[model samples]
Target: MKKSLPKYFRRFLLACAILLALFGLSRLYFRLTDDFRLSNITYKMPYRQAWEVPEMSEAQRENFNEILNQKFYYVGKGAQSYAFKSEDDKYILKFFKFKHLKPSFFVDLLPSVGAFKIYKEKQVERKNRLLNSVFDGYRLAYAIHGDETGLIYIHLNKSHELNKVVTVHDKIGLVRHIDLDEVPFILQEKAKTTRTVMTELMNNQDISMVQKRIKQIFDLYLLEYSKGIYDRDHGVMHNTGFVGDKPIHLDVGKLTEDDRIKSKEFYKPDLLRIVSKFNIWFKANYPQDYPTLKAFMDEQMQLIFEDERV
Candidate 1:
């Protein structure tokens, strides 16, 4: 029974309450209509088997088909794509995620004039550009570095082999049926990230093993550079991983081909970019071992830099 709030303050509070209610309702409307909107957004790209690897045996192809036949469980999502694990857990199917794929109330309310129209058109253009780039990257990665990148196939268009409705258990355990032929996706062999492996080794206090693994990672980068293939965003911890004893780049979206990368001008900067994050993490968590590893890495990198080809 305390004194009542001022009339202006009460009105402001009421206005806020009304705004919150409206916001919640709008969210509910979008959530309920998302699937319908997504269905109407069609993505069609040409089907091309431009390159094939003879090294990929018939058995491997058969195994890949078998995995596709089974149900997939959603794993996790990254900025670029949504990952779903095969039933056997040996492979992953990644579906590209697009921005601004659905109509928005606010955007529709605009009169479609001047800068607003330009902004809308640019957004659509960007979405298409991103989709094409990722598709090409997968194709290039398979052709140039399939084994290292673990890319088995790119299904960019509808195919009879993948023509069927399939079950998928999503991240929150919700079950949904997905039509494979209607969706474009990339199939890749799943592997543990470098950071995961390094953390384990560090926990075991196996400094020698950690050093060995880091050397392999460095060697992998050098090989890519020698081949004129470069990963522009080379975050070793997240983008590179271990497939058996070999280190491979997991994220192929940013890879590009340029012989200029092998030049002296690009060598040290590229190497430093790749190792920067790893160095920070090591220094923070394993300070006692950081100096030794840093010295070893520097020696190894220097040798690579001095190579005649480089």
Candidate 2:
């Protein structure tokens, strides 16, 4: 014979069952929504239960991991990172490898279950706060910021043309299109770096063209400077190249001071030296383009001087 449970006792048992069922469903939902590539990341590298790789599509992350394994030609290196041009040159993968995640702050504090609790509490913060800040600066550099692991994918230049489009994903998993001002700032490190720049490469075949563009870009910088922004990094000047007559600034990370920087001096003698060297090269190598190039330089200088006077 079964003993009948009291009414209050039955209610308590039923409530426990309902809560357990809801918890189970919530776990399942998390599993379903989670980006699967994160599992691959865990397998290849040490997993930080705190940080996660946002899921794009099912196979996108998997294919990206595979690309990392494949052989790629070395393109060049900026200050803090290396650039690898993919086999077909369809995309250039800029990778900044980071040290493995440290022991969580919770572990330092509690030495026991604190990491577990902190991980749960910070999961939302990691997903929301960290991602929000990165997405806001997507325009500063039109490259996708993967997790702290340090891999950035940039679209390759196809034609010498303006209005060329590139694809980058925002924090909310939507596609954002941007132009290739040779959009710079690929993999940004948290630490500060020396703002060292390379000297002029005399042996470069198109040195004359580069000089003209440099002078023009320098003028453009003055124009952009008036609006309260650093025009371009002095470091990657050599790497800057053209797509349909437009100069693409590659390294965008170098700053005058802080991210909200105020001013930097734009000197003329330094710029003139560059243009003069190029003038010699253009007359010797690219004579036909030299006349128009100087004309263009003169015109840009006119605009810059005019704006300065106003």
* Model 1 TM-score (2 dp): 0.79
* TM-scores of the candidates in the order shown: 0.79, 0.34
22 Cα displacement, candidate 2 (Å): 67
Tens digits of per-residue lDDT for model 2, 22-71: 99998886455332122211212222322222333647545554544443
Lowest summed-lDDT stretch of 10 residues in model 2? Answer: 189-198
Off by over 4 Å in 1: 1-61, 100-112, 307-310
Candidate 1: tens digits of C-alpha lDDT, residues 64-110? 66777888887776766778888888888877664333334465566
Candidate whose TM-score is highest: 1
lDDT, candidate 2, equals: 0.41
Query: lDDT (0-100) at residue 181 of candidate 1?
Result: 65
In the predicted model 2, the residue pairs found to clash are: 160-244
Superposed Cα deviation of residue 149, candidate 1 (Å): 0.6
> Which candidate leads in lDDT?
1
The lDDT per prediction is 0.74, 0.41
**After TM-score superposition, what is the CA distance of residue 141 in candidate 2 from its true location, in Å?**
4.9
